[model samples]
Target chain A: MTSKWFLKSTGTAAALSSLVLFLYANLRQPTLTEQMLPVHLKIFELDRTPQAHEQQAVLAVLKQQLGVTAVSFSQEGKTFSVTYCPDKITAEKLRAAASLNEAFKVSEKTFPPSPACPVPPLDEVKHKVLGVLRIF
Target chain B: MRKFVLYFVLALAVGMSLTACNDDKVLYEIDPNSLYSRLGGFDAISAVTDQFLANVAADNVINARFAATVANPARLQLLRNNLVDQICEAAGGPCRYKGLNMRAAHTGMNITEQEFNALVADLVAALNRFNVPEKEKNELLGILGPMKPDIVGR
Candidate 1:
């Protein structure tokens, strides 16, 4: 009889704790706003040889014309990469600058939308996956 | 009493799980027609193309050849419309391109690979001046670049 009573008391305590948690959760507000980062535009095929001062000058001109705050210049083999904010400057502007200088060739590739952008609407396969996960 | 408590705990767990699932709801989709509207549609493309042709006429490398054909604004405008339509359609937008295949259209023009590349550079500058976004610009170029096979023909 005493064991039964102890079991009952512990079960009752667990029930009360769960009840409080449920009430607190229901009262808690859901998060709505999400933070997004600025998009970057990449300019490819800039000269990367040791005498790349001309390339640097072209990049400076691009930065000034496009109103980009941050510029990253890096080399891989014979090519250089210039990554800047897409909101301010475009990849085409970079290419035009390169064309005028005759020192760089600009090619563009569009990256998948960044995580900062809300996920695109799921297709049927994605919908099925979410359904299997009971996420819908 | 113990049975009642056990059931309540189970119910709470299920409720929390269901609430967690609600966050996965789909919000919205990007409009399929956005690329057309963003590219300034037909008029803007023609305007930009006119400017691009003028720029090409002044470019030393390809200017001589380009100047000969670019004098005809009506022909250039038609070409621009076809180009924009191809770009728009390729980007999942609703525009039907009614232009000839690249090879046939550029045949016998004697457009060297260098001149073809210069035209691309000039078009890029024109699009940039018109504030076309990078993704749209690339989408447009992707359609244009594949034509190099026919346009360069070397």
Candidate 2:
């Protein structure tokens, strides 16, 4: 009788473990990767920055491009920020696309390095860190 | 005779009022055309930038000023970005340049007037390489030329 109880309990534990393992294997959250994110932003400088009417024209052209997800003009109306799928197109291609209307100039604007507060270059670090956190 | 004088004075007042209305055209008229459009937009701008950089690399006069930038690819690209932004922003385009202001950025760099002029010549060469018309070239330069004061020295 003692051995029978032990065997029954062990069998029950094994069955429960198998069921949980099967559920976890089937439904666990997918890992996060930088490629999966819509987090990249690039700033493009348009020389001969367009005026109000011309800005609309430029914005319209930019919005029509293939990979550009969003477009915004800075307050001064000389630089534009673009969010795009890095997978869809290269920055150089986007830059060329920006110059379609013979706008005076198009170039990527670089920000000065911040000595006081440094920023990470990409979202890879965050994805890599969060990738290891398995809640199940 | 007094009646004649009154008529003439009234005529003059009306003439003055008509003249005053003509001046408002200068204030309210918005030019839809931009030099940006005239210069072939982003295409020409990027071209000029590449040509300018190449000219800078080849020119002994200003190449030394960019020695550090040339040595580092990332730094060279950043410098290119900054230059393009300056051009794009200065010509009244749609970008607000977020980099350090010329004076502040150059404060300690101690860039000389000669170096500044050489840089302009390099840029002008690049502009000419693409056959940019005189009017557009001059207009772009006119807008950027004033920046010399801020860039020449601390």
Candidate 3:
């Protein structure tokens, strides 16, 4: 009987704690980014040195993508960067589109491949978590 | 009766005050050859704003200051809209700048004089890229120059 009472007390405390947390999360004011969907820049390494035509083609592919805002190749033409709305398109989608051509294969099998500075995936996680926590 | 005369006088006074308020709402008179017109109106202003943003992105001196803004598309677009509106309104165009004043916007940023000058230089470069005339460019710069005090070293 004593064990049962202890279990009940712990359960009650846990429920109350959850209620407080839920209220707090739902009540706080939304941040500036929370009000609008955020944009991200994804850079990809090209498989081979890009020719002028290949550079233009890659830019065209990314630019024609739904949420892409800006696309530019690196000075060396070995990598390119795309600024896009993640809510509308993903780096994977961009990789697929850019690799459709036989000549230029993008090394983006891993959504964010290595060889450049990363913006930290933690920001993406936080953006997604905020989206889930937001009640209204 | 005396009451009728008093009511009539009160109505006349109230009518006059309302007319005065209406005068304040009259449309602003813009000169026929205003800078806004010379700059080719809204489209030209928008083009210049886009070029300026590109220039700022490429500028190393001031690019770091705007990294966060460029990272967020919404914020970037807001900055673009505010810039276009500010320039339009300053040039006596049919636009109203509803954003925060220069001091308020740059208060916590602690912008340096060099950074501020770099920004102006970027804008000037953009105007030059568009081949804006010397007279028109100087006129626009003259209009925006006064905000330097409010924006720099704050």
Return the top candidate by lDDT.
3
Residue lDDT tens for model 3, A1-136: 9999999888766755454444444554442223333445555667888778877777787779998755545456775555566889987898888775556677631232212112234544544554566585
Q: What is the lDDT of residue B77 in candidate 3?
A: 50
Comparing to the true complex, what docking class would candidate 1 get? Answer: incorrect
Candidate 3 — which residues are off by over 4 angstroms? Answer: A1-136, B1-30
Compared with the true structure, what per-residue lDDT tens digits does model 1 show for residues B1-154? 7887777777676666655543311243436466656776545664455446444543555544533233332333344445555655555444556557676666666677787787798778778867888998987788667778877753
Deviation from native of the Cα of residue B30 in model 2, angstroms: 12
Against the hidden true structure, what lDDT does model 1 obtain? 0.52
Off by over 4 Å in 2: A1-136, B1-32
Which candidate has the highest DockQ of all?
3
Ranked candidates, highest lDDT first: 3, 2, 1
- Give one digit per residue, the lDDT tens place, for model 2 in B118-152: 77887787788689999999999899888888877
Q: For model 2, how does the per-residue alpha-carbon lDDT over A1-136 read when each residue is reduced to its tens digit?
A: 9999999888766754444444433334332111132323455677875789888877787678776655656546776655555678667777777776565588766544322111123432433333344234
Q: Candidate 2 docking: what grade?
A: incorrect
In the predicted model 3, the residue pairs found to clash are none
lDDT of 3 by residue, B10-123 (tens): 555543443343211126676669998899877788768766775665455665566666555545655665677789889887666746788777776678889888889888
For model 1, the stretches where C-alpha displacement exceeds 4 angstroms are A1-136, B1-34, B91-94
Candidate 3 TM-score, true structure as reference: 0.50
- Residue pairs with backbone atoms closer than 3 Å in model 1 (clashes): none
